[model samples]
Target: MRLAVLKERRPAETRVAATPETVKKYKALGLAVAVEAGAGLKAGVTDAAFAEAGAEVAPDAKAALDGADIVLKVRAPLAAGEGEVDELAMLPRGALLLGQLGTEHAGAFAERGVDAGSMELLPRITRAQSMDILSSQANLAGYRAVVEAAAAFDRGFPMLMTAAGTVPAANVFVMGAGVAGLQAIATARRLGGRVSATDVRPAAKEEIKSLGAAFIGHEDEESRAAQTAGGYAKPMSAAFLAKQAEVVADAIKKFDIVVCTALVQGRKAPTLVSQPMVESMKPGSVIVDLAADAGGNCAMTKPGEMVTTPNGVRVLGYTNWPGRIPAASSALYARNLLTFLTTFWDKEAGAPKLPPEDEIVRGVMLTRGGQVVHPSLQQQAKAA
Candidate 1:
């Protein structure tokens, strides 16, 4: 089978789907790889490195996608991206397209009759941890989010003590103690900041404190068990939210930096930080919303833009936090694609033979055999 890794056409996307190290893995599986020239350059993998791993360098985008049995990528093809929708038009019937799907255009891709699979849909089963691209990438976003906030802040993160003066450590508050939020707590703590994190899931309190962060949220026994088996946050009751907000609002006033990372799977992000909440912060504070692409957790955030209020508080809604750390992000995501791609026994019988009952396949298979294969997407198509 031929597998092609094309250079990402999206302007801000810096991650490539295949790295030189993983190219060798594909080679061992008897897969021929045609990597677009310089596809791994931004992620620190040179073309020569890919060549060393037994991949031929394609001259341009067309050659990269042509005659390939599978395509790997970071983002889905949008109508606007060069050679994006173009790939959709040219993909051979029954060919597989796998990558992260932006929530907005997911249905459109299904409508186009492409056999696309969404990487973000990978399940949280024990066997799939190595292939959990969302968690792997979120780990980087959480760490970088704090750094971005510190850079935007006028005050320093750590406490400073010199003969001339004694400076206090900045108070950092993190909303939503999921994978991203917990990492944010660890990052802020490592930077010598006093960190406190909150989440609707009551189970996260211990995880927060284990990272040396104060946990702030309702602790009722019922609320304490709010985590879903998949390790995601369940929406809290209105009464619970009202009480939790009270506990958080006071702490929010004291923090110098606030990181908002709350998200509900497959739904718009619930608003956690209200307009008045932003106004309550001290002057010169910074807020980085990791959930900005999902309509934002902060009421004032605008996706892909930054804003400041008249009171001197800064809110950054930059959407591509993972792109900021492209080299590492690409390496992890490439391994995920490799895991999903190499999950079959070709001994029999079929060129693209797969174990149909595989957890990863069932989780992400959006379309196959030219029919809408994902139940959620199929339901949406009916509603449309």
Candidate 2:
């Protein structure tokens, strides 16, 4: 089987799907690895490094993908426009493409007879944890959010005592207690900041407290059922959101930094910080919204840009937080894809044999047999 790694075309996407370390592993698995000339350049991997790992370096995406059995990418294939060739058109029919291909692009891949496997749809089961791209990437996003917030704020993170005077530690509030939010709380605490967090899920309360952050959320029936079995947040009612907003509005006033990571699966991110809430915050305070790409958890957020409000609060809304630390992000993400491949590799077939009965395989496989066959996409098609 020939595995090809293509260059990322998204404007802010600096991370690549494969690294030299993973390319070597692919070769050992009896797969021919071909990478675009500058595929890993932004992620700190040079063409020489990939060549040293015994992989072929193609001149461009078209050459790299020609006759390839499997294609790995950081994002979904780009459509023709904005100085980019239509990557989907170049893919060979019946080839498997794997990455963060969202539901919106399912129809295009199906029409081309390309079997698409979305890393975002990897099941949350224990056996599939190593291949969980969302958790791996979101963990870095959470840590980076705190780092960015600290830099944006004028005050220091840790307290100081000297002959001159005593400086109090900064206060940080993390809105959401998922994988990303928990890492933010931990990072804030590591920086000597007093951290607090809030989440609608009941399980998140213990997770927050365990990380030495105070949990702040009103307990109710709706809050108890806010988490799905797959460990993702479910959408909350308007009434619950209003009550939760009141609690956040009161607590946010005392914090020097706010990290918003709340997200509801398949829906726009719930607004946790209102414009009035931003106005209420003290001058020099900073807010980092990790959910900015999904419409943001703060009304003041300007996706992909940082802005300061009229009231003097800075809102950091860069969408690709992991890409800011590209080297580490690429390394971890490459390992995730490599692990997924190894787990599904078939010794007899010399290729990935995706078992239909396997929950993880079934969850991630978006299109097969020239149709949109993933359970979720099938349901979405029916609904449409």
Candidate 3:
């Protein structure tokens, strides 16, 4: 089987789907790997490195994708523009495309007869843990958010007593307790910041406590059952949101740094920090919105941009913070895709054989046989 890795074309997207290490692994798996020239430049991997690892460095995307049976990418394809060609049109019909192509774009892939696997939809089961792209990417994003916030803030993360004076540690409040939020709490704590977190799911309280961060949310019978079987937070009632917002407004005023990582799957992020809450924060305070791509959990956030409010509170809404650390992000993401592909590799067929019965395969597969096959996408198609 032949596999092609295309350079990311999205603005500010520095990550690549395959790295030199992964290219070597794919070669060992009996697959010929073709990579677009400069595919890994932003991620610090050179074409020379890929060639040394036994990968063909094609001159362009078309050359890389031509005759390839499988295509690897960091993001979904982009539509044609003045100076750009339609990336989806480059793929051969019936090709297996794998990456974080979200379900909302399933119709485009289905129309092209592309078997697309969205890594974000990977099951949370233990067997598929190695293939969980969301977790791997979010872990880096959480760490980067704190690091960037610290850099943007004037004060130190750790409390310090010097000959001049005593400097207090910054207070960091995380808005969610998912993979990203947990990592944020841990990272902030390690940086010596006084960290605290809130989440609607009752189980997150223990996770917050375990990370040595204070848990600050109303938890009752209703909230306890507000987590889905897959461990994702479910939308809360209006009454619950009102109460939670009140609590957040109070907590946020005392925090020097706020990292908003809350997101509802396939929905706009619930706004947890309102304008009044932001105005209440002290001048020079910073808020990092990791959910900026999903409409943000902070009302003050401007997606893909950083803006300071008149009150002097800085709101950062960089949509792809994980891509800011491209080398590490690409390495982890490539490993995830590699693990997922090898898990379903059919030795006799010499290609990936995704059985419809496999839960992991079924969970991520978005298009098959010229149709949007995923249950959620199917429902969305029907609704449309």
User: Per-residue lDDT tens digits of candidate 3, residues 1-384?
Assistant: 799999998889999999888898899889999999999999999999999999999999899989989999989987557238688888989999999988778988999889999999988899999989999999999999999999999899999999999999999999999999999999999999999999999789999999999999877777988899988989899999988888888778999999999998878999999999999999999999999999999998999999999999999999998998999999999999999999999888889999988999889999998988998877766898
Tens-place lDDT per residue, model 1, 1-384, is 888887887767889999888999888877889998988888888999999999999987678778888788898764545544465665555667888964455555556656678889888888788888899899999998998998998977899998999889999999998888988999999999999888878678788999999888767865876778888877777888788778877678888899999998877898888888889988999999999988999999999888997778999998878888899899889988887766653735434554447777778877766666676776777898
Question: What ranges in model 2 sit over 4 Å off?
Answer: none
Over 4 Å off in model 1, which ranges?
79-85, 102-113, 345-352, 381-384
- Give the C-alpha lDDT of model 2: 0.92
- The estimated TM-scores of all candidates read 0.92, 0.98, 0.98
C-alpha lDDT score of every prediction, in listed order: 0.82, 0.92, 0.92
Clashing pairs in 2: none
Q: After superposition, how far is residue 332 of candidate 1 from its true place, in Å?
A: 0.8
Report clash pairs, candidate 1: none
**Residue range 288-313, candidate 2, lDDT tens digits:** 99999999999999999999999899
| Candidate 1: C-alpha lDDT | 0.82
For each of the candidates, the C-alpha root-mean-square deviation to the true structure, in angstroms, is 2.3, 1.0, 1.2
Worst 10 residues of 1 by lDDT: 347-356
